[model samples]
Target chain A: MTQTDLAAFLAHSVELESEARERYLELADAMRAHHNTEVADFFMRMAHESGLHLEEVAQIAAENALPDLKPWEFDWPGEESPETASYEAIHYRLSLRQAIQLALENELAAQAFYASFAQSSADATTAELAAQFAHEESQHAAQLSVMLKELPPDDAHHREDDDDPHMPE
Target chain B: MNDVITFKAKDYKSGVKPIWCPGCGHFSVFNAVTKAMAGLGMNKDDTVLVSGIGCSSRLPAYVDSYGFHGVHGRGLAIAQGLKVARPELTVIAMGGDGDGFSIGGNHFMHACRRNVDITYVVMDNEVYGMTKGQASPTTPMDWDHSKLTPHGPGVRPFKPAALALAAGAPWIARAYSGNPNQMAHLLAQAIEFPGFSFLHVLSQCITFCPQQTDWKAIVNERQDAALEDEDEAARLFLHEDGFQTGLLYQRQRPTWPPEAAPPNDPDLTGGFRL
Candidate 1:
């Protein structure tokens, strides 16, 4: 990998963190709309943590002029960036524990992504940076796991029943 | 790249959380629309989105731009009027399959024939998700889950792309929500085209039609290249399955509000005074 490759890799890293933040914010909004304030607040906190990660990535990016790439140009192992949460996995009645679990899964995926990149990169600097990023993602995942354990056991049947359904009367 | 103002996809969002169900395909479409708008370097103030009643109609609220969440099935009519009144604005009309093909079916046809310089994006989820799991105009003949249609709708589904082609729309295309980047590219191209453009998006309703989650496996890129000839387009549309996604037809045509007349002209109504 060359300087250009490193810049591209950093750009992707920045995007992954940014997307994760955005996705969490969107989930928080969705939860609020569903009148689930408890879960919404939890999601908001997760989003704030993701924002801190984004700032760190931005600080690194400030050290180098990252290449501007289109949303489609990034070569992710999956259909989208590794840390971006799946939109389909959200439910209006989702529990706080479930939300944290989802974030934990995304953090683990991000960790795995960086680990693979570090192993595959031939350039020493790129490999070292990837390893460092992987370590940071592992820490985030560990923190989320601890947060999940602190939450009360989720009751699968604790969903609020709508008095007036949206179905045709 | 000199003087090019770059924008990220998130910059186009309104920051208002979408209330759409988790796993809903509309989320991808929303993301794609914003990406397309940003890719075009469109001025948020100069762009407007209009939509009728449906789950997909909520798209305008999520996009940070001028929008109108109009009455049920009248999104196209409102969009056309706005486009005519303010031709400089980039007007886009969006709704679900039921809103466009059933209640607002007539407006859909005329909007295409009128050739207004507006883009219409119909998120076809087959079933009416907003009103629970009811069969919509695009629902398959064999979909028999609805109590109202215990034996299924038993009618042929509406073919949106072919109908748009027949109705004189100059640009017609289909995209899948499963591939947001490709959808964004298609949307950008549709917006740039100088005629009435119909973008049919195969967005799935995960709650009502959970089986459609397999669309990621079923949808395929169009093997045949985009057709510039009307006859060739018609042949391709008629023969191919609806799962093929890409620009199917495009042709240069005269748009509405033909060159404006000089402002100094005498009032034509003066001669007709009674």
Candidate 2:
């Protein structure tokens, strides 16, 4: 919650990326199991991106005396980490468009979270680091937006019988 | 143990992707379980997750630890037996509303009063999701979404936390899958609780009950929800709607089998005298 301290900032950043990567991988696996290969592959790509960003955060964490914090201890703007996409917005039958949109939304939330710390942190070092992270998140969001724009119109739909197929009479 | 690497939340997963619907709340509950394990640095081999038949019952297969996907509505029974016999293992029983509060309703009540040193997690989506939507024991009296209950079940739903409290459970809590952080925190606390601990989780069955998607906005954490006093907790449960989530009730009680059991009898008829 205290983003002013470099240790706290790094801890939060590391958790945000870690949680994001885990969620994307979970989503990818779920879709893959359901035979939604296209959406699954898209989620895996997003997971790869999250993993790369996580490596950067982990590298920074290695250089600093990062504080150990519980998963629930982080004071995020919402109930979950900013980059962890809301479960309500995704489903196994999700189309490629929805997946890209969800990724973009996560990136935007992460960018806003970092921008908040960049503008409000009392520690100059934390502020500079937050600004750099914010810029990176913005680039990711922009890339997702372009992906969304390029998606074919027919690729943005869920299965017609996406609901249950075996209700007992 | 020294040769073991520290497990993160993901590392606790069994690598089997859950077949739950995309927006189903069980996904988040699964994450919360793994998070709690990682937070406690629990040894996977020493921990066992047990479940009965239901959509949520598939949970055991997703965990990297020892698991028992038992018969319908019998998870708590199996878990209790395992814990009592093993004594050294950590046991957690899990299932959905229909499985726990309906078919296993009797077992649920007795499990609470038995005061076994185990944790019961009921993912209350208020429907029989595996059956493709039927009114569960915890479903509201007037829920008419299912054709089977065209005029509604017209029966008041079971208040799990209240029931647990009345059945003499020492620790009771309510959590929402939408609030994964708090859910994980509560789960860790429940697992560590000495006596019988009951955690009622509001997990949505998005395929059968899409209206439940609104639960994220409806549920709220209340500071005054948890109480150490039995009388006050009963009054609070009577007054509050199910929306209030957190550790709802807690009280210290003597565990049934005690924390650690005596050494196992060598003879099969050793306890026949009883």
Candidate 3:
């Protein structure tokens, strides 16, 4: 699980972005089910960002022999890829504020993952690559943090859409 | 078709994204299925997803592969026919517990006995999710959440893996939705198995059975390794509470229709082949 070489580290990076993109798309579609179009669109935009990053990493590593590690084989810090949102956090009525906060937290976690590798990896080239990824993740987190601040002060507590969760009769 | 070097789970996904509830376990299963397909390098044009009616039956709509969204409880029958007609294509049949064990119980039994070269996956949520949450054939006898079964179904649930082996399926495995990675691993193996392979997925219907979230802590890996002996597997299934997940049994046999099937009879087939 430890990234001892550049190929392994790049593989992990690609996996992280892939997972993040999938999770965002899931959240967006789930929100759409509850008619939360605004939040859904926001999540879609985040997914696009992740997709772009994933493309860049994949394009460069297409020729490299990235190890095809099983899903459980990945040595992720959390239960899943650092950038993937927690399943417990998903809901049909998730508010835009909560969605943004969740994304921000995931970005921070990804940044931390790359940062730890940058500091602990013994291989100099791998460490440098991890550092670059860490910087990029930090920027993503900062942007999300700003989005969080710009929302209404009470939005943080706005996890669920309305007080009632019952379907209309 | 895709090369291993170009493996991408998203490539196996359709244009529409899955939209299950907040705590719904199907999300994980969906991801696991796509990951498994990508890992196997399955060709979208050659891989077929057949399903009966239910929440899980909607799976075909989410995958980019060829799909046959058939009527309720006929998934196995249809999938078997498809695989027999086109032996070269990879066929996967999937649906909910209600559809597979109740309405299609007869077909399920025969599918196991016939030993067709296809995969069958049952998303056993233990409740009829699409019909607003009623106790399913696999619902616990003690479960009393549904008003219709407020005092509990008071009926023993169908033991899927045990039943599969009894009916003569060559491969049987149980997987938990809480562990998508493990589910994906098992799925790839089941798909590669060259005979009737049944994978029972304990997918939680969080919208109705919110308590199922606790399955994360309750479910455990099987204590014993994969068993090839039917009697040993039977004894294992009989004693366990069915919370254990892993490859419980495998006994490959020559697939059905030992030779190419004869020309289809329009009377029986109605000239409608999958």
Q: Fnat per model, in the order given?
A: 0.28, 0.55, 0.30
B150-263: candidate 3 lDDT, tens digit per residue: 878999998988888888998999999877778888999999999998999999877777678778788887767789988998997777788889888988788897985776
Candidate 3 error regions (>4 Å): A55-79, A142-169, B1-7, B259-274
Estimate candidate 2's alpha-carbon lDDT, on a 0 to 1 scale. Answer: 0.88
Q: Which predicted model would earn the best TM-score?
A: 2
Over all chains combined, what TM-score does candidate 3 have? 0.85
Tens digit of lDDT per residue, candidate 2, span B1-274? 2136667788899988799877789999999999899888899999999999999999999999999999998999999999999978999999999999889999999999999999999999999988778899989898887889977899999888788888888899999989899999999999999888999999987777778888888998978756899899888777678888898888888987855565497675877777
Tell me how far the alpha carbon of residue A100 in candidate 1 is from the true structure, in angstroms, after superposition: 5.0
Colliding residue pairs in candidate 3: none
Chain A TM-score, cand. 1: 0.89
Candidate 1 vs candidate 2: the TM-score winner is 2
Question: How does each model score on TM-score?
Answer: 0.86, 0.91, 0.85
Candidate No. with top DockQ:
2
- Which lDDT value does model 1 have at B161? 86
